[model samples]
Structure formats: structure tokens, C-alpha cells
Target: MFIKLLLQVVYITVPILIYYALIRNNASLKRYHSILLGIICGISILLCMSFPISFETGYIMDLRTVPWMISFLYGNISTGIILTIIMLGYRIFLGGIGMFVVFIAYSITLLMILFYFKKYSQFSFQHKMKSVLTLTFINSLLIVSSIHFIFGFSESHYLLFYTVFTFMQLLLTWLTVYMIETFRENDRLQLEMQNSEKLYIVGQMAASVAHEIRNPMTVVSGFMQLLYQSDEIPLKHKEHVKIMTVELERAQAIINDYLTLAKPQADKMEKIDVKEQTSLISQTLSSYALMNGVDLHYHIKSDENFYTFGNPEKMQQVLVNMIKNAIEATLNKKAVTISLSKDNEYIYIDITDQGVGLSEDEIKKIGTPFYSTKEKGTGLGLSVSFSIIRAMNGQIMTTSDMGKGTTFTIKLPQY
Candidate 1:
């Protein structure tokens, strides 16, 4: 009896597990395939039907309970209901004397599970384990009573049958849930590790290039400045000289961003007045905003005190890059707002822009080096900003709708 029960478990588990793995990558398919999966489950039950083992009690024992409960436990409500209906129809069509009794048992189990569906879905593994044990205990009692009354199991076999089947169900259900959860956790960790590897590679390359590029840039910048000052130079040529000087300065700035990312000076950390720093940044960007025909405004939620430990310069650098990005994003609709607020644990700086907002893919790659949304952007702005924020133990949260706008919130731990 035990071997038969174990064999049935293996047969049902194979298809169920394979189906779960195939649908794991596509969440939409998992949502849409529930009914079809249930139908497949109903069809799969033919294996048990063809090789049914009847106990001396005139009752047939099969592994229908595995899929019946699994559908409710892991699948959506529609799936569980459909599975119940299909299984009930199959049982009735098979035309056994215990068909009515099996239908009643299945109905009671489904109704009870449906009642706690939402609550059960929210339970942690430990809590769900306790609930599963309780439910299995209740089902064991029902099974014993049904066999004794409807199918008329002999007294000697009733206890043995109830004990064995209940134990098997409990063991198999726990194993299934554990395996699925483990797979989910492993998938999440693997993705996170891949992202970490990308960041490490980017940082290594940035460090290598920064020092090599900075020296030549300084030499070019110095010569360009000297050329600009020469009275012997033609005025038109000096205009070209000025443009070269400006482009050189921009290149120097980008290189500095890279160097700062590669070698963050940790010893410079100190408590910064977040509100004051935000105000200073806003004031500095005011001219830039006006020149671009964008209304940039800064608001302090209160004169509320908030302090965080970081290199104040780097923190301000992060703010500058983010605010500039916001300003640039305000392409035609020229309104940008920067705000500061404080909670018990963190100081919050929010920059919101009425611009062509980011798409989902763009948002994911916002801080990736060499990836940018702007036509002429080098994309180091946000990438360097991401590094600076991480060095300061802070987070940048952004939300955007494609045409509406974008909001960036910088969260830093309060000292």
C-alpha cells in the first residue's frame, strides 16, 4: 500500500514540477495557463484510474489529493475551482459506488480551502506548515469516517489506512512547497550576483582609464587656455579655441567623475546638514535652470533638522548630476522641482521633472555606464552619481511614465 502511494506521488509530481519550471520564467504564462494546466491535471489522473489499488475495505486509494490541494495552495483561485469541477466530473463518469462520497469529500475540501485562500497565500512557510498539518489531520478524520460509514471499511484496517495516507500526503506536500520556494530564492540570488559582477567590471575599467586620461586632458586644457590668451591669434580662430577649451573642460569633468567613482575618499566622511546642502545645490543650479528656460524651484518641507554622514562634496556632486539630468529631461515642458524632507531614519531629497520620462528599460539601465537617454549625453552623470550614493550608504529611487514625467528620490541614512 505504501509503495503504491509513493509510486503515485512520483507520477503526479513529475508533470507538475516540469510544468512549474517551464512557466517560471514567464509570469504572464503562469497567470493565463492555470485553467489549461488544471485540464491537463484532470487528464493525467487516468494513470491512477488505470492501475487503481483497492483495499480490503472496498475503497480505492489514489493520489488525487496531491493535485487537488496543490492547485489551491500554489495556483490561483480560478484554477482550484476548475480543477475541483473537472476532478468531480471525472470521478462521476468513472461510475464507482464511492463516486458520490468522493464528490462530497472533494467539495468539502475545496470549499474549506477557498475560505482561507487569501489568508493562506499570505502565510509564511512555518505558518503554512502548521496549517497544512492541521488540514491534513482534519482530512484524515474525514477519510476514516467516510471509509467506515460509506465504503464500510473493516475495523482492523481503518486506523492503518488513515495513518499511512495522511502521513504520505503531509510528507509529499511539504517537500513540494520547499522545493519550489528554494528554486525561487536561487533565481533571485543569481540575478543579483550577475548585477554585482557588472558593477565590479565597470568600476575596474573606470579606474584604469581615469588616471591615464586625466594627465593628457590637463596638458590640452592648459595649452588651450594659453592659446585663448594670445593676441596673435585671429578672433575667429579664438572662437574655435574657446569651443575647444569648453569641450576639454567637459571631458575633464567626465574624467573626474570616473576617478571619483574609482577611488572614493572614505576618510573625508563627516556629518552634513542635508537641508543646507540641498539649498546650496539648488542655488548653484538656479542660473543653469534660467539659461535653459526651465523653472527650477527648491522647497524645504520644514526647517527640520536632518544630518547624514558622508563627504559633503561628493553628496553635493550627486545632487548636481541628478538635478542637471532633471533639467535636461525638462525638454519642452520646463518645470522642475527639488525638495528636501526628513524622517526618523533618513533624509529625503526629491527631484521631479516635467519632461519626456524614461521607459521601463531605460530606467533599469539609468546608472549603467555608457547608457543614456539624451542625444548627446555621455551617461556618466547618473553612473557616477550611483557610485557616490552607494559610497554614502544611500539609495536612489526613481519612478517614471513614458510621456508624463519622472521623480527621483535620494534616501540617505540620518546621523
Candidate 2:
């Protein structure tokens, strides 16, 4: 009987190991994995039930209830109900003197479990163990009582069968409950760490693009702005001026953000004033925004002392990319705003734009190279900005809606 119990226990552990290894984390098969678990548990239960050891001339027993109880303990109501039906039919198919008793016992237990499926599912592990203990006792009592009346089993035989069955069921049920919870928690943590890795990669790519991109953008924008501002420029060419000046400034912003992500910082790092920096960047780009039918607003809610430890050049780079993205995102809206504030450990930069917004999927992949919503976008701008901010020991977070707009918050640790 002890050896039989050990073999029955394998039915529980083997299926669980197979499930966690092959089905649990496989996205394509995950949707139906629970239903698949129910089927495996049913097979394990049936295998044990059919091969029970004979306890007496009129009494027999097995650890089949352990898997059945585990199914309900795991609280899969629909699957449990389906399996209960399968068990009921199988018991009737193997009809005999003691079979009626097993049928009565299982039916009573299963009906109560089905009725309280949700309540049982919400139970703490300890509560579930206690409830299953009580239910298992009742089921054993019903089966033994029926055995005594119908097949004339002696008291000693009844005691021996009841005690062993209940002990095995309770022990296996508790172990099953504990293991499943651990698997779920592990899966959640793994997902979070994967997201953190993507941002880290962005920071790496920035190192490669440094000096190669930034120098050319600065020179081009400086020349274009100088030309765009000339009084001799023809009236018919003003629209082209507005487009060229705004776009050049926008390009510089994208490259700066990209570099921060690469974790390479050669620019002078010091405690720089946030208000002074925004004023300089905005002054340079205001005409570019005007040409694109948008207004640039720099809202400095923090005082002059609101400073962060970062390269001044890189700081302006992220701001430019943010403002440029805002201008493009502005559909019917006319204003793009960059706000600044600070605390003891971090400086917060909020760039809010009124333009075409991103969908839920696009939001998740915001910093990926070559993934963009715009027709001609290379998708490296925001991704590079993310790298630059990360390189400076800062973080970038975004929030958006379909028709509303997007707001990006860049947080840098206070120097």
C-alpha cells in the first residue's frame, strides 16, 4: 500500500514538470494550457483509479482523489466540472457492489466543490488546505459507510482504507498548491527584466553615433538658421525657410537623445541651470516652430537653482528631439511645451506635444531602431534620445492617448 501511494504521487509531480517545461511559458500554446493541464490531471487520476490495490474481499482504495482535489484546489471551475463528469461516468462503467459507494462519495464532494468554485479559488493556501481536508474526510466517511452497508466490510478494513486515502490526498494537494504559485510569480519577474534590457541596448548604440552625427547637424542648423534669418531672403521663399530651419533644429534633437542612450559622454559634465539651457534651445528653434504653424513654449516651474549633473550639450539634444517630435505630433493643435522642475535627487523634464498620438503597441516599442508611425521615419530619434538619457544615469517615461497627445518625462539624477 505504501509503494502504491508513492507511485500514485508520481502522477501529480510528473504532469506538473511536463506542464511547466513545455506549456506554461510558450505564448502560442498558453491560452489553452490550463485546459490541457485539466486533461493531463484527468488521465493521471484515471490511471490510478483503475489499478487500485485490494484492501479486503469487499473493500478497495487508491490515491485518485488526490488529483481530483488538486484540480479544484487549483480552482479551474469549468475544467473541474468537466473532469467530474468524466470521473462519474467512469465509476458507473466499472459498476459493482462497492462502486456505488465510491460514486455517492465522489458526487457529493464534486457538487459542493462546483458550487463554491469561486470561493475556493479565492482561498489562501492555508484556507484551501483546511477546506480540502474537511471535504476529503467527508468523502472517505461516505465511501466507507456505503461499503459497510452494501458489501459488508468490517470496521478494521474501513479504518485502514479511510485513514490512508485521506492522508495521501491532503499531502499531495498542499504540495500542488504551493508549486503553481511559485511558477506564476517567476514568470512575472522575468517579463519585467526583459523590458529593462531593451533600454540598456539603446544606451549602447549611442556611443557609435557620437561626433559622427552631432557635428554635422550643428553646422548645418547654424548655417540654415543664419540664412533663414537674412533680410534679403525673398518673400516667396519664406515657407521653405520656416521648413528648413525647424527641421534642422529637430534633427539635432533626435541625434542628441540617441547619443545619451549609447552610454558615451565626452561633453563637459557639471551642475548646469535648467532654466538657462531651455532658454537658449528655445530661442534657436522658435522660428522653426513658427514655420510649421506651431508655437514653442518653455515652462520653467523650477527656480534658477534647479540644476542636474549632465553634459550641457547632451541635455539640449534630448530637449530638441522631444520638441521636434511634439511639432510633428501636433495635428490640429498649435503648441508644444517643455516644462522643467527639480528635487534633491533628480531633475524632471516634461515635453508635451499636441500631434498624432501612438497606439498601445507603438508605446511599448517607443525606443526601438527603425520602428516608426510616420511614413518616412527612420525611427532612430526617440530611441537614440532614450540611450542618451540612460547614459547620463537618467530615465525616460512616456504617456499618450490615441487622439490626445504624448508627454515624455526625462529624469536625471541630481548631481
Candidate 3:
């Protein structure tokens, strides 16, 4: 019985190991992946039930709930339902009065899981372990009680078996949850390291080439401007020079962005009034917004002044970049709103736009160098803004709905 039970555990653990190995580098699961996960859990359930530890006629024990609960908690709702159908169907096929008991117990268990399912993914690791353990205990207790009522134990030996069975179930559940969570954390860290390496390479390249590229561009731009103003040049030729000069200025701006990422200049940190800077940026961008036919609105949500420690100029730059993006995103006659508020520890600046919003995949790629949603965008503006905020010990968070719009919230530690 011990060896058979250990084999059941291997049935569960091996699939998990294989599945995670197959998807170790994936940032998110696809639909087929979820189906594959359901199939994996279902296989574990079927294997455990086929080789359950038998105590008597119509009485058996297996760690099936471990995989079932894992399916519901870690996989999607459809995956959970698929596992349920598979488990109960196989339980019936095994031909036991215990099948009815399991049906009742898991029906209740499914409801409880569904109630907590939405928030389970958001829980901390400790909370998740507690939740899984609690559910496993309840499930084991339910099955034990049902078995006792339906077919009473004939001796103390059966009772001892029940205790050991429950303990084994809890232990396996804990181990499985711990292993999966550890893998998830490790994968997350690996992804962050990969991103950091990419950023480092880009920064190094920028530092090496930005000045070299800028010098020639600046020289060309200066000559173009001279041609634009030269009386000797034909009017049509001067117009072409003007266009060249404008393109050069745009190129210079991009190089400046590269420099911002490559070597951020050290600035003296000062206590910055968040409200003042926000208002100043709103005024500075108001004309630009008007030119785009977008309404720009700014509001201070509290009477108290919000202050944080940062370079005031850089703070304004971040504000301008974020707010300008919002305005550009908004359609003509739509509104872009900026609101300032404070909590106990952080001041919040929210820039919202009434424009077609981003998908989850697109949102994840934001702030990546050279990634942009707009045509003619270099994508360096938001990257520079992110770097600036990080230097000031702040964070930029984004939330969006597909058809509605997007909101960017900048949180800076309060001073």
C-alpha cells in the first residue's frame, strides 16, 4: 500500500514537473496550455483512483483531491470543471458506494473553491498555502465522516488508517503547492533578469553611439538651418532645408532620449511640491492638447500640499511625458484628465485618456525600449520617464480596458 501510494504521488508530481518544464519560459498560458493542464490533473486523478489504497470492500483512499484542488486554484474555471467531470466519471466507473459520497463531498468542495477562486491568484504565498491546507483538511474530514456513517469501521485499525490517510493528503497537498509556487517565483525572477540584461545592453550601446551620432546630426542640422535662411538659396530649396532641419531636430530629441537612458545625470534631490509641478505641466501642455483638439483637465483632490523628494526638473519631465501621451491617445473632442492626490505614504498622479485602450499583452510591453503603440513614436519617452521615476524611488502603474481607455498612475513616496 505504501509503495502504491508513493507511485500515486509520482503520478501527480511527474506531470507537474513535465508541464512546468515545457512552459518554463512562457510569460502567460495559452488556452491549449490550460486544457493541457486540465488533462494532466485529470490523468493524475485517474491514476490515483485506479491504484488507491484499499481498507475494505467499497472503501478506498487516494490523494485525488490534491490534483483537483490544484486544478481549480491554479488552472482556470473550465479546467476545474473538466477535472471534476473526469474525476466523478472515473469514480463511478470504479463501482463503489464511496462514489456517491465523493460526489456529494466534491460538489460542496467545488462550490467553496469557486467562491474563493477569483481572489486565490492574488493571495500571498503563505495565504495560498493556508488556503490549500484548509481546503484539503475539510475535504478529508468530509470523506472520513461520510465513510464512517455509510459503512462504519469494524475496528480501531480502520480508524488509524483514516488518520494516516488524512495526514498523507494534507502533506502531499502542501508539498505540491509549495513546489508550484517556488517554480512560479523562480520563473518571475528569471524573466526580470532577462529584461534587465536587455536594458543593460541597450544602455551600453546608447552610451557608445549617442554622442557620435549626435555630432554629425548637429552639424548637418546647423548647415540646414543656414541654408533655410540663406537669401542665395531658392525658396523651394529653402523649404526642403526647413524640412531637413525639422527631421534633424526630431533625431536630436531621440538621441537625447538615448542619453537619458544611457547616463542619467546626477541632480541634487530637493523636496518637490507635487501639486505645483503637476499644475505647471498641465499649463505647459494645455496649448499642445488644444492643437490636437483634446481637452486637458487637471484637478487637485486635496487641500493639503503633496510633496516628495526628487529632482524637480525630472519630475516635471516625467509628468510632461505621461500627460502628453494621454493627450495624444485621446481623440479630438475627448478629454484627458490629470488628478493629484496623496495617501499616507505616497502621492499619486493619475493621467487618464478617453482613447482606445491597450490589451494585456501590449500593456506588459510598455516602457520596453523601441516598443510603441503609435506610428512615428520612438518609444523612448516613456522609457525615460520610467527610469526617472525609478531613480526617485517611485513607480508607474497602468490600467486599461480594451474599448474604454487607459490610466497611468505614478506613485512617489511622500516627503
Of the candidates shown, which would achieve the greatest TM-score relative to the real structure?
3
lDDT of 1 by residue, 1-415 (tens): 6567667777677777677676676755654555656755665566665556566655567766766676777666777777777777777788877776676676677777878655454354576777766776666567667767876755668777777667876777677667656765686457446645666776688788877888898898899999999999999999999999999888888777666656655578899998888888898998998888899989988786879999988888889999998988896537899988865566778899998788765676777777888889888788778778877877777777678899898988889
Q: What TM-score, over all chains together, does every model reach? A: 0.57, 0.46, 0.64
Once fitted onto the true fold, the runs of candidate 1 whose alpha carbons sit more than 4 angstroms away are 1-24, 27-192
Worst 10 residues of 3 by lDDT: 24-33
* Clashes per model (N, Cα, C within 3 A): 0, 16, 0
Q: Order the candidates by lDDT, highest first.
A: 3, 1, 2
Provide the RMSD of all predictions against the true structure, rounded to 1 decimal: 9.6, 12.6, 6.7
Whole-structure CA lDDT of model 1? 0.75
Q: Report the alpha-carbon TM-score of model 1 versus the true structure.
A: 0.57
Model 3 lDDT, full chain set: 0.84
Q: Tens-digit lDDT track for model 2 on 316-387?
A: 876777777788778643788888876445677888888767765577668666677778787777666765
TM-score of 2: 0.46
Per-residue error for 128 in candidate 2, Å, reads 3.2
Q: Where in model 2 is the C-alpha error above 4 Å?
A: 56-58, 73-75, 119-121, 192-415
